[model samples]
Target: MKKILMGVLCLSTLLCGCTKNKDIQIDDKKVGQVKLKFDHIVGAKKLVLNDGTYSNNSNETFNINILKYFVSNIKFTKTNGEVFTIPKEESFFLINASQSESLQPTLNIPEGEYQTLEFNLGVDSLTNTLPVEKRAGVLDVATNGMYWDWNSGYIHFKIEGTSAASPNASKSYKYHIGFFGGYETRTVNNNRVIKIDLTKAGISKVQENLSSDIHLMVDIGKVFDGPNSMSIATTPMVMHSGPHSDIADNYATMFTHDHTHNFQKIANNEK
Candidate 1:
């Protein structure tokens, strides 16, 4: 009888242990939130629209009056090789430099350590061609001037400012870049897929109760000087009709992973 009681007690302990382990696994599977924070800068200086003056690689001094871009199709790769893609409806975001609320885009993902972050610098081809009803919110053409009528699609990236080096009479330069392989005919596609390895800077650790923020530095100076450099004096106006491949290649290298804040408590509003 003593031996039998002892065996029963052992079995009970094993079951309890298994239940605890299962609870832990369930907790690990819980969904967490992450925020992508974009810090726009010119070289090392913070970007201040309308007032702050900055110089590019071409030695042209300019003051940005407007800066806007789209970020979509965000995907996070876990350290264990699992990739989590945000739902299509929740992935599109417009980052306007003048708007404080548009700086950080949030995502809900399973709790894990993300080692890589990938996203499209512009609106995807399918999303851009979606019907007017489907393209609401930030993608709404009426809300923002980021969209063209019908033939041009969406403007992926736009920067407008006044530069003394510009040859224009207004001393202004505008670069409105957009082309998603064209709707009817093939055109210069400026949509770029940017992939950043987060291991070196710091991987995002998302937890159920905690929110992770991946801080990235966007150097606008690279727009003028990257793989293919351009001068404000020469190419002051880069509209949809001009060659944008060089500018696209240059802006692709603008983002760099700065660090990750993995221990931020989820705000009451965010929850």
Candidate 2:
């Protein structure tokens, strides 16, 4: 009877250890929410629709009448190099200068200490190929007027404004960029993968079930004054494949990490 009693106690101890390990595993996999805010500016001034003054590296003066773009495939890389990719269907976002609310986007990700944030400046090729009917979530909304064509693909980025460099009466300019083909064939994949270092902000850990907000700034000047700068006087409108690629490449250099804020919570409880 003494030996049997000892055997039962050992088994109970082993069961408790297993339960504790299982709980720890579940907690490690807990997911958290991260909110991203896109702030637009031209030089040191806030970007406003219809009228925002700014000068680029080319010495060309322009006032933006429309400024909108798409960001997709947002992911975070932990200090150890583990990547937490946001679900593709829910990852695409359109930021419009005219609409203040579209600038803030909330994303759910596995809780971890992220060292870097990565995202695509334009829609991915696969998602771009999907027909409008087959697309779901944010992609299904045609009324947003972001699409270019079903066979070609959606316009990943767009900007319309007036530049002093243009000789036209209205000084109007329009630039739209996207892939030029369907399926595996594409003339130009303007999609850019942008990585931002977050160590400065000390976003070491995103607590489980809590919400963290990351503020990013998009300098409009970089669109025209980037590595391969363009002038409205020479090429005021770029709606097709050629010059659009150069501008898209420039647009890729417009984002920077500003800061971060967090709202801590305990699992399912808010604090």
Candidate 3:
């Protein structure tokens, strides 16, 4: 009887060991969510900048008529050489000021450390041709003025500022920047990416579930050197900001290195 009991106990122990090993094996191919947030550091909604710096001084503040842009193709890179891209179906994001209060927004990320991030500064050809009824977020027909009488496509960015530099206005420089059409020179197209390898390495140990909020600084001054290369004299009208789009492309210059950002952590209640 003792031998029989010992044999039964050993069999139970082996089964439990196998079950425990199976439980410890986590699926490494799980998919994670990628979030995006934006911040428009415009000095004031109604106010404007003289030398691209927001100020309370009357001489510095200029009235703005419109300011909008599109962000698309949000992507991520893992430290181990893996890449994740926004699904082709829902990749574009519109970063409009009228829709949101500020420019500094947070992005949602999965539960792993990312090696790099890539995003577009303006709308792409695929999104531009999308009909108003099909648009979402900043691309909504109600907000974005990209509609060219239902014939043309959406404008990538509509930034209008009024100032002395603006169309002979009393204001300093009222500027309006937007895409013209689906197949016109007025349309704007620009994309940018950054390597956050160092930053990713520093925070690799952090679980994505722990960090939910991330900060990305958007500096308009860096986008276009107001008083510098992009002077009011040269880029006064949409036609000017377009043909000279290369000059306007400096917005990337404003995109600097990464910094400490915030996000949600794994919930204590979560198993």
TM-score-best of 1 and 2? 1
Clashes of 2: 0
* Root mean square deviation (Cα) for candidate 2: 12.0
| Model 1 agreement with the true structure over 1-271: per-residue lDDT tens digits | 9999999999999999776121112245698889999999998899999999999888889989999999999999988898989998999999999998899988889888889999999988898778888788999977789988866489999999999999999999999999888777888788999999999988888878777899999999999978888899989999766658788888999999999887688889888
Answer with 1 or 2, whichever has the higher lDDT: 1
lDDT of each: 0.88, 0.77, 0.50
TM-score of 1: 0.89
TM-score of 3: 0.63
TM-score of each: 0.89, 0.82, 0.63
Q: Rank by TM-score, descending?
A: 1, 2, 3
Tens digits of per-residue lDDT, candidate 3, 1-271, equal 9999999999999998776221122234543333344544643332232234343223333344556665667777766767767674566665665666434333344455565667766666767666657777656766556544544555554555655544455544433333433464544444334334336323322233444334455556443443235545445555324443553465554443344333345445432
Off by over 4 Å in 3: 1-37, 42-65, 98-110, 131-133, 170-209, 226-228, 239-244, 262-271
lDDT of the structure predicted as candidate 1: 0.88
* Regions of candidate 1 where Cα sits further than 4 Å from its true position: 1-28
User: On a 0 to 1 TM-score scale, where does candidate 2 land against the true structure?
Assistant: 0.82
Instruction: Return the top candidate by TM-score.
Output: 1
